[model samples]
Target: MKTDNSALARRLGLYFVMLWFSIGGIGHFVATGTFASIVPPYLSDPYALVYVSGAFELLGVIGLMILRTRRIAGIGLFLLTIAVTPANVQMWLHPELYPIMPQWVYLLRLFAQVGLLACIWWSTRPAPKAEGIRNGPQFP
Candidate 1:
């Protein structure tokens, strides 16, 4: 019998996403000074705020990794991504404030957020049933 690879795929996908988000959250802590520069000028205490954001990211990633809470975690990740978009926009608009990064890098980072948002949405989507597939050789 063929192994049910769908479940395996889902698990692996979740692992990658969990690892990605969790590390990104940790990066906030490790690179607090650098990360704070990207916060919009209007915001106060950027450093402290980022630490709180990192905590949420860590929690969301952990929740997604565990089966029982995957759905809720996925939802949280989706919302978090949306929530953080303002900082991304700030980075893109004011490259001068983030002098450490090149303009092109900032632009690409903005684009990457779109992909990350899509990936989080896709990773959390409910898995389709195995029977939903119609197996057959294609003929043309």
Candidate 2:
């Protein structure tokens, strides 16, 4: 038996994204206060922002699972990750404010977010169609 490693990797990546967002989306509702605390003060209505982002996260997960919707979902999720950079930045900028972990951990999260974006972009991309000469029906 032979294995197609690229296909395997892509499948794993897609599942990772789905699971990550699914849990995070649920967390947004279940632990609204904890998620809301991460929101930067500059933003208005922390709760609303949290809810909206959470809803988007869940939507993205659904879109990711369906082949027809994967592309749009990847795009939306990529932008969402970018959109939340500021909150991550704030966490890094002032460790005193958010004591959830050490300063290094917050900084590591910023880096991890970049990796996450890359994963979403690469994994959700449509697989290339196989190429071969037609067995029949030849034409210009």
Candidate 3:
């Protein structure tokens, strides 16, 4: 019996995102107060927004785990990444706000965000069609 490598890759990719976002969701839950503190000052109520965003992340991760909803989940995650860019920019702009973590840690987080965005992009990308000599009727 031969195994389809693409299928395996897809499963691995799905599992990777599932685990990655799950951990992020947990971190948000565990450090909601800290994360709220890190929210940009422009937000009217950073604490409420942080928790709401955390809930969305947790739900998105759970949705991504199911095959039927994988595409939607990927889309949601992609939007979430884009939506959070302000925070990334704010962190880079004001490192002192994240004093609990080293400067390098915040930079690493930004890079990791890029990686996650790439992964989500790869996962939701349409599979390429197989190309082979046509087995249909041909001119003699």
Clashes of each: 0, 0, 0
The candidate scoring highest on TM-score is 2
Q: What are the RMSD figures for all models against the true structure?
A: 6.7, 6.6, 7.9
Candidates in descending lDDT order: 2, 1, 3
Each model's lDDT comes to 0.75, 0.82, 0.71
lDDT of 3 by residue, 1-140 (tens): 23356644655676787787788778788898877777788887887777778888889987765656667878898898888878887887788877776777788888988988988876654444431112211112
Better model by TM-score, 2 or 3?
2
lDDT at 35 for candidate 3?
76
State in Å the error of residue 23, model 1. Answer: 1.0
Clashes of 3: 0
Scored by lDDT, the top model is 2
Which ranking of candidates, highest TM-score first?
2, 1, 3
User: Which prediction has more favorable lDDT, 1 or 2?
Assistant: 2
Model 1 TM-score is 0.81
What would you estimate as the lDDT of candidate 1? 0.75
Per-model TM-score, in order, reads 0.81, 0.89, 0.78
**Poorest 10 consecutive residues by lDDT, candidate 2:** 131-140
Better by lDDT, candidate 3 or 1: 1
